[model samples]
Target: MKVLGMLYGMAVGDALGMPSELWSREKVKSYFGDITEFLDGPKENDVACNFTKGQFTDDTTQALLILDSLIENDFIPSEKLIAEKLIEWAVRTDAFENNILGPSSKAALLAIKEGENADILTRKALTNGAAMRIAPIGALFSTAQNKELSEYVFEVSRATHTSDVSIGGAAMIAYAVSASIEDKSWEQIIEGALNIYELASKKGAETFTASIPERLKLGIEFADLYQDDEETFTQKIYDVIGCGTMTSESVPAALAIAYYAKDPNRCALICANIGGDTDTIGAMATAICGAKYGYDAIRKDWIDTIDSENSVDLKNYAHFIELHKPQFKGV
Candidate 1:
């Protein structure tokens, strides 16, 4: 049931933040004040301007593709398979031949479309695209060993973002989701995620900025200092950790928000308020929080809105995961 919450949380966060993506923190604050409901994107923004209120963007769409692939394969699908599905998705959604795809994913998917090997194509790529769609992977293999989980993270991530930093970011999110589903304590979850980051860093994964583990630690400290002050906490997130599309910035920021918010709705709201790359951060943070809090924690209105607007079947996804749990027992 909590897995259902995690999936819906991803969609809710994605929809809640859709309008605020790419806006600066000040611009977001000045415009929305505090985004507690789904809103349409700015007319001037090409990427999301066409979307209606409560519509999720590519984050949820792509993650759903990964989820479908997992259900079909009964394990982590191969890079080639995932890459092919991405291209098919792009074509179906008209994201192909348009400038709608993310930098890393676009490059790798294009390379695969042109008959290049996915692994070779993504060897130097790094972006949050892989991490954005990784929650399903975590849910599918939550019981796997760390080494096995890391291997699966690398495999799926290499389809679009093969750089060590990108892979590391995906790994941490995957591990965190897995830990959250297992009902691990917040401290244990953070420690496990940080350990994964450290291991990936040691393996020469390239990072876009400061260490993610370091930023996460600092973010937790800031959260403690501003427990009762949402305004200061938000500003500090922008000032210290950042909230960009880069893996280093967004991944840690999402984790930090999850740690601070502790509740799925608050996590999504905070991510929406933080502005840049809000959809991805909100999706990531709220998924973890949802895993902790369960499906009942989410608002029914938001879930209904997402379903009606996006035509997604949240209960069907939950049933699929439940039915396929046995196949992943020893993985």
Candidate 2:
């Protein structure tokens, strides 16, 4: 149930955000012309993620595979397991079989194939790829919330995302989700993550808080730029956030959505609208909000629209694995 809550919530966010993945706020207003309720694909966007209307992309797929690997291994993950499971899941799905791996992940996997040191290999790459697939660490370690757990989650990320910001972002999100699962308030989760970030390397608590409003303004401003031309919404925000590469832009952009959106669905929709790494930010926000609010909080219609073969199976699989989780035995 805990697993389903996280995975399903993530897919809902991914699918919801897919339509307006790169649109700015004003562009979204112009595109949807309203957007009060759940809407379909973003108009004039020729991207594949948005091509299928309300659908999920790699973020949810990688995350679901991560959860599957952890559950299959009894919550203990290693570099080899992660690589193998990712390739396996991708090949089975036909999405990644056509050679569609994310840039950082592709590099990391190639390094693994060459038998390079996992630590050194991870440090060499600091893409959002690591943070993109890190939601399961939060769910798996939801029970262990102290500094010890924080350290373990950091180590879990270090195996793949060794850069300061990359690892810090993953750790922060994991801590927030785990803390939220424990029923902490939104402020509590954010502050807890801020405290962790402050203690770990260059990521400061004040920096996190200060970045929020700034990023939100950027998103809103980028959105406003498209008031005249909805067609340029994706490109304009992509220019602002530059969805091409780097975990810094992707992680923080995703965090911005969660920070502004307190509600589960709202967070998904808002993050999706922020653009550039739309699926990633949307997926991350969904994981955080889902962990906080549970599966019951996400709207049913959004859940229904997800790509069933990939999305629904993952949710069911995650839920089945959650049955043996000791913390959830009674609840």
Candidate 3:
């Protein structure tokens, strides 16, 4: 159920926030008034216009790609296969032609498509493209294997986002998901995320980006201080913590939102209305909440909507991850 929650939570959040992707907080409020439920992607927004109601974006697509890669290779993933899969997806879905690809990922994939290595393009890449799709890595491995989990995080992320900032952000989210799935309290989960981020920061090329761990700490502090007021909480998240494409901005913001909202559906709903990289933040945050709370915590209507909307076999991936971990097997 935890695994299912993580999987479905990612898609649910992604779909719920799809319509408002990349809009400003003010723009989101003005256009939709308030996103209480999934709405059709407005033609006015550039990236969001590609999607419809209850449809997820590249965030969930790439995550499921990683999940399927693991499933096909007997639960082992190789960098080569993941790259191949990304390219295949890009070609199949015309992601390059469409506006679905993230900036960092688009650059890296372009290099790969041109018969070149992605290292140069990825060397300075720092965006949530990696962190957004990293929840499965958390669920597939337990928090006890923190070192091993960080290594997998590097492998999974280095293709597109090779900067230390990017890897650290991705590691933070992944550890949060793993810790949440293990039923750790939110406090302990934040501690684990900060620790793993420090370890994972040493894996990739260093960059001039903001520190994800430090920003995550700040975001959590904001959450704690603004807990009593929804208006101030969301404002702090949007204006101060930021809701941008940068891994450092969005990843920490997502973690903070997860800690603040506590509930999966609320996390997604808040992200949906908060604007600016809404789908990615929602996907990352809600997945953590879902892992902690289980699938039952999610709204039944939302679950059915995701199932009916996306053809991706979320249950299969969830089942595979559940069986992969020893603790969840035969439950």
Best by lDDT: 3
**TM-score (all chains, Cα) for each model:** 0.94, 0.74, 0.97
Tell how far residue 121 is off in model 2, in angstroms: 4.3
lDDT of 3 by residue, 32-151 (tens): 998999888999988888788999999999999987786787666677788889889999988998888999999998898898988987878887888999998898777888788888
Kindly indicate the candidate among 1 and 3 with the higher lDDT.
3
lDDT of 2 at 5: 65
Candidate 3 colliding pairs, count: 0
True lDDT of residue 44, candidate 2: 71
- Count of clashes, each model: 1, 3, 0
lDDT minimum window of 10 residues, candidate 3: 322-331
**Candidate 1 segments exceeding 4 Å error:** 117-121, 200-209, 329-331
Query: What is the TM-score of candidate 2?
Result: 0.74
Task: Estimate, for each residue in 1-331, the C-alpha lDDT of model 1 and write its tens digit.
Answer: 8789889988998889888887889888898888889998778666678678999988888888877776677665676677778899898878966456888899888878888775654666656897888886777666446776677777666678777778788878888888888989998989899988766544334546567888889988998899999889988988889899888889989998998999999899999989788989999999999888888999989988988999779789888877776567533
Show model 3 residue runs off by greater than 4 Å. 327-331
Which segments of model 2 are wrong by more than 4 Å? 1-3, 19-51, 91-99, 114-121, 142-144, 198-245, 307-311, 327-331
